[model samples]
Target chain A: MKGRAEVRVMLKDTVSDPQGETLQRSLVSKGYDVSRVRAGKFLQLELTGYSREDIVARLEEICSDILSNPVIEDYEYDLEEVLE
Target chain B: MKGRAEVRVMLKDTVSDPQGETLQRSLVSKGYDVSRVRAGKFLQLELTGYSREDIVARLEEICSDILSNPVIEDYEYDLEEVLE
Candidate 1:
């Protein structure tokens, strides 16, 4: 079955997030009155020809191997069946 | 009250996502048997001194005004109370 998967990849706690820091700075510069801005990445995939279990397993691998850098990032995901 | 807010930002349909395309190519090259990779940005904020409703409204403004470019991107978010 065809399906959609959403993978959210984020910097691990020990990693330095320059991008997030820069964004926070910008927001503060604009006088938004906010703090503690952490940023990450989100990926949505259109996956095909796999059962739900297969898709989940494959996606988990893809997330760890390709979607994120293990030393610096972590990931989570959601999957749903989709119409072809 | 202190709370956490998650914001997901993505390119609009009309925008070209070179990063996503490049990632897709890299995944394909690695023989992942996958297709259609769309990527976006996610942000987690540690916000303070606001009611749930206030936080939601402020975050909506922050997302539209700073976190995303309306001409080319869109965003969504979830907010939850957190311990200080």
Candidate 2:
């Protein structure tokens, strides 16, 4: 079976985001009403697997172990079966 | 009105993504069935405006002008009404 995953890795609320803060400052100075901005990483993966259970388990491991730094980042993913 | 926007910025298909390529290589070597990976940027913005129309217009400008680069990237966003 083939699957597609959309993953998002974001900093925990306790972690400060310098890039987001800088962008917010710039936007505010430019007279935009943006109050806050948080920047993170997005990943799309295409995988081939034998079963849905296999894919789900592997994806969970990959997301936490390889894709995100668990100390400061939180990651979430949505998976769907794909025809291609 | 208060609104929240989730924006995604991704490289055009024609552009090479070295980071994604490297990650894919690493995953393959780790005995994963991953065939391809594409990495991009995710942003969550909290904005305030007088009405939905006002927020939407400003967010459109902000996304194109400040959040994403048009040269090699494409951006999309989803907006929702927020109580706070």
Candidate 3:
């Protein structure tokens, strides 16, 4: 059983993006005119066969509980089935 | 003169992804045991000042002549400079 998906975890707009800020600052220092950079996380996960609803619910639950914060983070996911 | 940027375009992976496979076969026929999904395209542009290496060399020459496609599509950009 193999499950695969791409998950994008991001801080809510209201939350500060320290990594993005640092990256932008670096670019700016290099004379890159960088202004804003919203940093977010992307992840790829593999799992076994499961109901999409169940997986999605679990994913969302994980996001709100640990992967991200309901208070300052949002997430998106893309699930793919590898039929070999 | 204002310039903003937050462009993330994808299509570089052998160039084939039908909207992440119809959104993982509509979440595996609404039961959700999706296996794989890879859809990529995100953009958020806001511009004010320029110079960040001349806007990343004209945004990599407009992502190799038109927002993306070096024969396989690989791009990542984030240039915010809205100091208004």
Candidate 4:
């Protein structure tokens, strides 16, 4: 079976986001009414597996150990079966 | 009125994503069954506006002119009203 995953990796609330802050400042300077901005990462993955459970288990490990920094980032994913 | 927007900015299919390629290589080396990976940016925005229409109009501009490089990237967003 084949699967597709859409993952979002974001900094934890306790972590300071300097990039987001800078962007907010820039946007404000340009006269936009934006009050806050947060920047994060989005990843789309295509995987091959024998079963849905197999893929989910692997995805959990991959998201935690490789896709996000456990100390400062949190990751979430949506997985769906792919016809191909 | 207050609003929030979740925005995704992705590279066009024609543009190569080196970062994603590198990550895919690293994951494969670790024995993952991943086939393809594409990476992009996610942004969360908070804004103040008079109405949903007002916010939507500004969001469209912000996404295209500021958040994404029109030549190589494309952006999409979802907007929702928030209670203050």
- The DockQ values of the predictions, listed in order, are 0.67, 0.88, 0.10, 0.88
- How many pairs of residues collide in model 3? 22
Q: Candidate 4 — what's its lDDT?
A: 0.93
lDDT of 4 by residue, A1-84 (tens): 899999999999889999999999999999899999999999999988889999999999999999999999999899999996
Docking category for candidate 3?
Answer: incorrect
Task: Encode model 1's per-residue lDDT on B1-84: one tens digit a residue.
Answer: 777888989999778889888888887787765677879998998776558777787788889988899999989888889875
For each candidate, what is the lDDT?
A: 0.83, 0.94, 0.61, 0.93
Name the 10 consecutive residues with the lowest summed lDDT in model 4 chain A: A41-50
Q: What would the per-residue lDDT of candidate 3 be over residues A1-84, giving only the tens digit for each residue?
A: 454766767778888877767756755665544456666654444445456666666666544664456788788877766566
Given candidate 4, what's the lDDT at residue A21? Answer: 97
TM-score, candidate 1, is: 0.90
* Winner by TM-score: 4
Model 3 Cα lDDT, one tens digit per residue, B4-38: 77566667667777866775565566554545555
Better of 1 and 4 by TM-score: 4
The whole-model C-alpha lDDT of candidate 2 against the native structure comes to 0.94
User: Can you list the residue pairs that collide in candidate 2?
Assistant: none
Model 1 CAPRI quality: medium
lDDT of 1 at A16: 85
Model 4, C-alpha of A62: deviation from truth (Å): 0.9
